[model samples]
Target: MSTFPTSLTCTSLSFAWPDGTAVFDDLQVAFGPGRTGLVGVNGSGKSTLLKLIAGELTPADGTVRVAVEVGYLPQNVTLDTALRVDEALGVAATRAALHAIEAGDATEEHFDVVGDDWDVEERTLATLGELGLGHIDLDRTVGEVSGGESVLLRLAALLLRRPDALLLDEPTNNLDLYARRRLYAAVEAWSGIMVVVSHDRELLDLVDQIADLHDGRITTYGGNFTAYEEALAVAQEAAERMVRVAESDVRRQKRELIESQTKQARTDRKGRQLAASGSHGKALMDAMRRRAEETAGRNKHLHEGRLDDARRRLSEAEETVRVDEEIRIDLPSTAVPYGRIVLTVEDLEIAYGTGASRALTIGGPERIALTGRNGAGKTTLLRTIAGDLPPVAGRAEVHVPMRFLPQRLDVLDDTLTVAENVARFAPRATNNVIRARLARFLFKGARADQRADTLSGGERFRASLAALMLADPAPQLLLLDEPTNNLDMASVRQLTAALASYEGALIVVSHDMPFLESLGITRRLHLEGGELKEIDREAVGYPS
Candidate 1:
């Protein structure tokens, strides 16, 4: 740990959702100066804790103490499109004052506004440049920047504040490779109490330590994400070994208890036979019978106590084992014949307002990865193919049943439950059938009844995925846009597992290289400079 002073401290912090979902109860944690990666499975309250610390949500009990200024960047960032870049950066007034003073109209109020930030404009430009927004002019409207750039701009605003403590939630969710690199650099250069909640492995690797939030508790591990994983592997191995030992002990104790009972029964039978045969006087036989009865009761109690102790040990051991379930389903109907044409783009022009055009044909069950820099119209192309957007020119056609999983995952109705969402896609399927299929997605029983709006980032993604995959007419061609955007690592693995079972043609537009590689992408396409180009994996900047 760094020698810097503590910037944030939570003392017995407690919080719950309006629906009475308890997230944290008497949770306590402290962060000193240095970068800390906060990680956990989806819905494990990583984001919730950050919100609590950031004061975005109020706690029902306990206290959160922040000794310094705090800056927070939430998962989704929205800015007023009409606002100028400087205004969005929170430096518009100071910049204006400085300019007025330079122009010899130095009013006292302007002097007060300018204060000591006379170089605010230069500092703003420098910060923007550091975040790969050097091309963005201070006078440009927020509408001019792309979504990814908008996120960076928000972060730039936070940096400009120079808060002593920073909390970032999934900051790299929509960032492309180049933008991600810039964010990574900013993280590396930070020197303060920085707590980041993200599943980006590359970004997590730069942290000074890792904080794992699970089961309403936080466990700190010294070192980066890789080191934390190694340590966790060791702990899990030990826990599993203990569970095996405990199971064996329970079996042994059970056998011993049974043997003791059998021995007592045999002794009782022998005593009864002696007593019936009149081998001893009546008084002596009665006394011996009482003694035997007492001994049997004592032995039974001892054996029972031992058995209970063994079971307790087994239960404790089992609790130590982690439960990270993966989604496993077989969608054989989604398969396409080897020579069948699945989709064709005949000189199609996307509605990206950039006149980007592409002509392509996808056959069989090929998996295609669409990649490019931000603002390259990958999402627009996917939308056109999904029939949600009309092509500006030419024609895009799908020869088979198709489904689209958009980046926002807005397909599900907020008022509907997970099962209901699935049923919406598979209108003819019975509730029982939908429930069974949803169970494979890990939404068994009451989980299937959860409202779409109530789901965490990961759960929502799984729900959206389940709906698409469990449709009545199986989708032979699936179009996905940034499917892994806000998912945690475990959820990402679950998605990969689910896709492995999908034998359909796929066209995924994403910045996640690992996920594309996991899908065994048969082809790569890049949208660049207002045109589609077939490229090798290296051209897409993915490792071989």
Candidate 2:
């Protein structure tokens, strides 16, 4: 932790996609020294804002101002496989110069390159070690590392620069449990102006504050994620109450308007009767009728205005109540009978480069949590079970219809609409049937018509999940690999809700402990040393 006067400020920042989708409009936000956890539902522009601040994308209008140097770690990190660890860390040139000087070739240029950083190699190794990359050699190429390690390597590069302001977008998306712990520790130790966009609750719990980006605005809340949740709970409660009051007011106004209309109709009939009865002079009767008509019109206009106001209030109140849609679907077709063999892998070996293998059996509707370190072939095993890969040694037998949701979610066709994608999976299903089910997944009407490429991360996940769940014959054995990797809290909740209704045997490979526990896992298995070892939740280093 360093006491540096650093800040990140956005002034009237506005941005829109090329397709004319407006993300932010004249948004103004400022982040000073301290860790700020940026959270919002997917598609709320959290990542877009981070990109704008990082100067990766130019805002359509306004400006982003930073008081100090900045470092950014994007959500998807790609590294040149041929580049060495030292090159990726941006210290290769300096290290070369230092080596040259050490070799007694003390050229002026070499001295200039090595100036004041004679221990650059040591610092680089130390930083990598701090990020749990100590075993990685500086001379080793990036192709030798795992995806999670690559992310950490990128972060390590940024850490070596020691920027005053830092921004991280979903840094824990690909990290294993151990790597996530290291990242949490790093976030805890940071004291500069830091903003992290993530949906990992445990990671967010380490932040000094929470910045909720919603509806093109950022609202800052003091304390960690727990405190922010508490505040949100209170706000939602109040908003619900307001909605109720508004509903009552609207009902009352509607009743009054009806009563006024009825009274006016009665008055009109009475006036017509009086004029027809000739109880007064013709001219006097006509004048009285005119006066009555004017009064009736004015009263009608007043009542209508009141009713409109009440309706407007109700709409505003409803807007304040967050619409966290839940997936509601019945999956009785996916049910597996008790003692039924769902999946069996005997001496199975994945075809990937990782020499990992597994031997296991899943029965009934058992919920299994697959846990392992990064590069341990968890994904490879899942792919093998999904029939995407042939086993190098043995066979995997699936007794029932199965579906696998991969981390990349590339199962969808970007050129097709969401409904079309679902139809591709369940070809027999009529458009009406597909739409009816997609509505439960929250892709109603026009949303279902939206192209797969146009959906946000959360929306795409929902569409993919819908396609799997609605597939023909149903998925009696469901496999999800890192399902919650890029999902926001709301999407995760929706996923949990959808899974609750599923009566199938499930094998979920994930590092998200809380999500796994919420599924009521019947067994926890650790994939290590080419074997599946059953363990308890606590044994896997997860908080019980």
Candidate 3:
């Protein structure tokens, strides 16, 4: 900590990719001592900006200034499996030094290590418990927990360090509903300067304000996520009105220019007739002809200039009406009959550590939401249902055609183009058919030819969904696991709209309550304590 107030600011920041593509140019933004949510559509450079501020990614120009130390939790967290919990938390040395002193091997070196804060163990336990990690022992190995737990562990480490400023990117991606609640509580209790980049509605609602990064520009709005959206909706409405007015002006100007040009043509013909008839002296006729020619030229230039001005105004007005394109998934072939049995589970136990003994069945287009705590085997169950993993016992089956979109989105082949990836799922389909089908996912034209490795987070998700939706058999039963994890707000809306057109059975595993609520889920399943049962929406702490 320093005498100055905790702050993080950037001046004239500029950055570009190795491929000569620009992401930011001369961006100026300042963040003071308060919680701020950073939001924008995918590829808008929210994560890149955080990396620049945290010194992880250096800017090509300008500078990042911070009054005190900053702690950053990246979107993807990887820890050494060989390390112990204490070592991962950066407290191994201090804890070891304390143990030695307690064993009567007290030395000046030990004292230096312990410092004045001797209750490190108590603090560590409290922090872990706060993040729903109380069951984890200090000596536990990093490999012993689930992916979501590892994220919370890293967050706990940062919390105990108590840095002046904290930066979190997609912190709740892998967390379960319960774990997400814990993370939300931790965010609410944070008193220092913090900036979070996340699509989790609950977590974003805890922010003091929102900093929206759009088209390489930062726009600040007061209050939480809902407030920011309300404000944006109002602004977008006003911009649309301006666009209408400007368009009308452009049409009026074009009509006036055309009429004026026609009138001038008629007058020019009359002047030519008078000159040809020699009604006056040759000098007067020649002078009049020159005067008429100059006036016509002047009038033409004036009308053209007016039309150009009107067009320019229209263009400017259109630029102000910013909106993200939506993915269109109209799978008429995927529709299921009313009496069709889409999926069935009979006393099935996933190959993972957890076990479920309850029977389940999904008929017609019933949308099911699967939720549970971390390490509760949600992913395992989905994998088993998809036939990717063998069930420990009983049977898990899908009666109709199905496609699974895993949380990692690894189904895509990186070297192949978007159209090619979808083609892989439908090898018999022609390139023209694949590309035409891909347009529904918002990957039209050259975008459909882009390699999978080159796509942004949202684009990758959409491409994956496209591949699944356009498969040869046509997915009649779509199984999505954490589909909204890496998606931005706009992409989530696109996915929701796309799902509305699915016309088939769906079993989606996600912790995003708002996203689930919007899907018109017919039932909710909770898997925990070696049992799977139907739970009411209100029982899960959300409305229908």
Candidate 1 lDDT, 89-191, residue by residue in tens: 9999999888999999968999999888878998999999999999999999998787789899999999999888889999997788999999999999998
TM-score of 1: 0.95
Cα deviation at 231, candidate 2, in Å, is: 1.9
Residue 329 displacement in candidate 3 (angstroms): 2.7
Q: Across residues 1-544, which tens digit of lDDT does each residue of candidate 2 receive?
A: 3454536889999998755668899999998888999998877888889989989999999989876889999887899999999999999999999999889997999999988998899999888888889999999999888888999999999998889888999899778988888888888888788999888988889999999988888899999999999999999999999999999999999999999999989998988898888889999988988898899899989999999999999999999998755556656477899999999888886765566555788999999988888777788888888999888888899999999998878899999999999999999999999999999888888778888876776677888988998899889999998888778887787788778878999999888878987898888887776676788655645421
Q: Write the per-residue lDDT of candidate 3 for residues 75-127, one digit (tens) a residue.
A: 87899988999999988888999999999987999999999759999999999
Candidate closer to the true structure by lDDT (higher is better), 1 or 3: 1
RMSD each, Å: 2.2, 3.2, 2.8
Per-model TM values vs. the true structure: 0.95, 0.88, 0.90
In TM-score terms, candidate 2 sits at: 0.88
Better of 1 and 3 by TM-score: 1
For model 2, the superposed segments whose C-alpha errors exceed 4 Å read 1-7, 261-291, 325-332, 351-358, 413-420, 429-436, 444-455, 536-544
User: How well does candidate 3 match the true structure in TM-score terms?
Assistant: 0.90
- Candidate closest to the true structure, highest TM-score: 1
Ranking by lDDT: 1, 3, 2
Please give the lDDT score at residue 454 for candidate 2: 68
203 Cα displacement, candidate 3 (Å): 2.3
Q: What's the distance in Å from true for residue 388, model 1? A: 2.4
